[model samples]
Structures are given as C-alpha cells and as structure tokens.
Target: MYAPQDDTTLLVDALADEPLAPGARVLDVCTGTGALALEAARKGGRVTAVDVSWRAVCTARLNARLAGLPVRIVRGNLFAPVAGQSFDLILTNPPYVPAPGAHRMPRGAARAWDAGQDGRLVLDRICREAPALLRPGGVLLMVHSALSGADPTLRLLRAAGLTASVTERRWVAFGPVLREREGWLRERGLLSADDEKEELVVIRAERPV
Candidate 1:
C-alpha cells in the first residue's frame, strides 16, 4: 500500500480551504490510502475514491472503514469506474515521476509513482478527461511535480475547456525514489545538478457554470 507522501499531503493541504456544498459529490482519482477522500468527507462531501491498484483500493477501503467515513472505493483506472457520473469536485495525485524506460508502466510499487518517459502517462489522461467528470461550476484539484511540466497540465485543462491555474506550489526535497534517480533527471535537463529540491504544484481547474 502506498503511504501518504509529500505529494499526498500537498494535495490535502490544497483541499483544506476549498468550499464544498453539503453532500457535495467529490471524486478522488488514484487514491492510494483514501487520505484525501477522507478529508473531503470530513468536510461533509460525499466522496468516491478510485485507484487502478487493487491493493490501493483495499487499503483505502480499510482506512475509510476505520475512520467511519463513507467513501465509495472502486478499483479502476482514472474515471472508468465512475463513468456516467458527474462530481462537484475531483482530486488526484497521480504518477508523475518520469521513468527511464519505454512508456510502459512500471511494475509493483513503482507503478504508484512512475509514469511514462515524460512522467505524464496517467496525468495526461486525467487532464483531458476531468472536465467531463465534473459538473458545471465544479473544480479539479490535482498535485504533481514540476518534473512533469506544470504548464502542460494547465494547458491541457484549458484546451479541454476548463479554466485552470496553479493555486499552490511547495518546494520539497527529493524523496528516496527521486534521490536515486537524480542523476538521470539531471542528464535529461529536467533537474539541475545543484538543485536538491523539486516544486510540487496544486493545479485548480474549474468547469464553466
């Protein structure tokens, strides 16, 4: 099971002050341990959490049960499990770590963090499909590293007909996985040799009313 990391914490912090109507429908994509989903529910929103990893799904369900919060846990990629449903808010902390190999998914725990060569394997899909999952005036709050190109995220959302912008950004030191891959990142011009910190940004996109 994936633990709550800096990216997850950053996403939750961004959701802290977000306004939610009572019983608002909130969808959390790639929910690892249901942390964000639980936070949303605590704010009085009805939450649904989805993840491609069955382990993650199970972990999230258990966490929700232990917390006594009502979060619908589903096992599926992106928005598939919730097709035909629209939400008042959407949240995601997807795999944005650039993998060195072919765009194929990394196996095991790596799957939770490794994206494609450019680290957008799953993030791109979310950026394009999120608007459809949101109701009018609904919002999407997604967190990812700058290594994945924050501007690209914003551009994709805007091109898909949503108003998007970076609402929060925090610089954090590289985690174990990132620290191990630091050399390769620098080789690819993604990170500077002297830079030990990476910027994690919370992107907020809203569907027009």
Candidate 2:
C-alpha cells in the first residue's frame, strides 16, 4: 500500500522533463494508485499501469476513471501483463527496503517497501528484464534507494546493451520503514549511526534506435 512519497515526486519531476510525444505509449510497472500513470496520460501519452496487488489495481482504475483518463490498469506481476508489447517509456518505483531476511520479508501492508536483505529483490529483476520491454529509442525511468545498490542497477542496464545513467538524485530523511530498520541496516553496514538520510536515484536507460 505505497502512496505518493518523495521518491514518487522525484520520479514525476524527472518525467515532467521528458519529451513525451503525443500518443507515445507508456507503461507504469508496480503502479500504486496510478499516480505516475495518470501523470503520463495527462501529458498525452497512452498509458497502461500494472500492479501485483488487486487493491492497487482497483485503486488505480478508480483514480484513472475519476480523473477522466484512459489508463488501462492490469493486475499482474511486472511486465507479465504487458508481454509481447513494447512501450516508448517505462516507469516504476518498486519495493527497495532492506529487510532482515528473505523469509522475514513483509507480505501484507509492507510489501510495498520490504525487499529482501540486500533490498534488491525487485530492483534487480527490473534491471535484468525491463530493457527488453522498451522499443527502439524508448527509455526506462526507474527510481530506487541508493542503499539498494544504484550503481549495480546502472551496470546491469548497461550490460543489457542500453545506455544507462543516473539522471537525478535526492537525499531524503529515512522514512518510517527505513527508520524502523535503521538498526539492522547499521548492522549490515548499509547505514551508519550518523546517517539519518538515504539517497534516491532516478536511473534512465534508453534503447538506442
């Protein structure tokens, strides 16, 4: 149940600067509440949003309808719902919290933030596979915590034959989830006693035409 937060705003800001041509296809993976999807639709992009949570799908659908936007909301894992199709842009803000253990990962409400130990559970897969979903000249704009290995994500994207770079970064104070796990994170050397903030990075990877 992730709602709009600083990371969301950062991604939206980055998106606002993109040159989205009219009717450009946009896919929002793990869209929670359709925030990014709606923003893209408002910019004249044909947008589709996918989520693993039934509740999130419902919320996004309702939000789109209420906003009078034609956003297709699908209930499925990342990329599954949009298989066999390509998009001009892909946007996502998946879970990246560094939980204690794999088995200790959150299920219900915390699924939005509790990624396994290294916090790369979902981020790694997105980097590994999302490049294939982009059409030639298309780009992916994904946002996640630097604590979750932002450089690794950039490397992964580059290895996939895409031009990748960190377009933006912001230092935000530890949110509730991060604050709660500060101790464990410190133990893992992912955080420090004086570290009260975490850096969020927006990674942009483009498939060359």
The lowest-lDDT stretch of 10 consecutive residues in candidate 2 is: 101-110
Candidate 1 shows a clash count of 0
* lDDT of residue 159 for candidate 2: 95
Q: What is the lDDT of candidate 2?
A: 0.92
Q: How well is each residue in 55-85 modelled by candidate 1, as lDDT tens digits?
A: 9999999999999999999999789999999
- Residues 103-180 of candidate 2: C-alpha lDDT, one tens digit per residue: 874787777788898889999889888999899999999999999998899899999999999999999988888878
Q: What TM-scores do the predictions have?
A: 0.98, 0.97
Pairs in clash, predicted candidate 2:
none
Model 1 whole-model lDDT (C-alpha atoms): 0.92
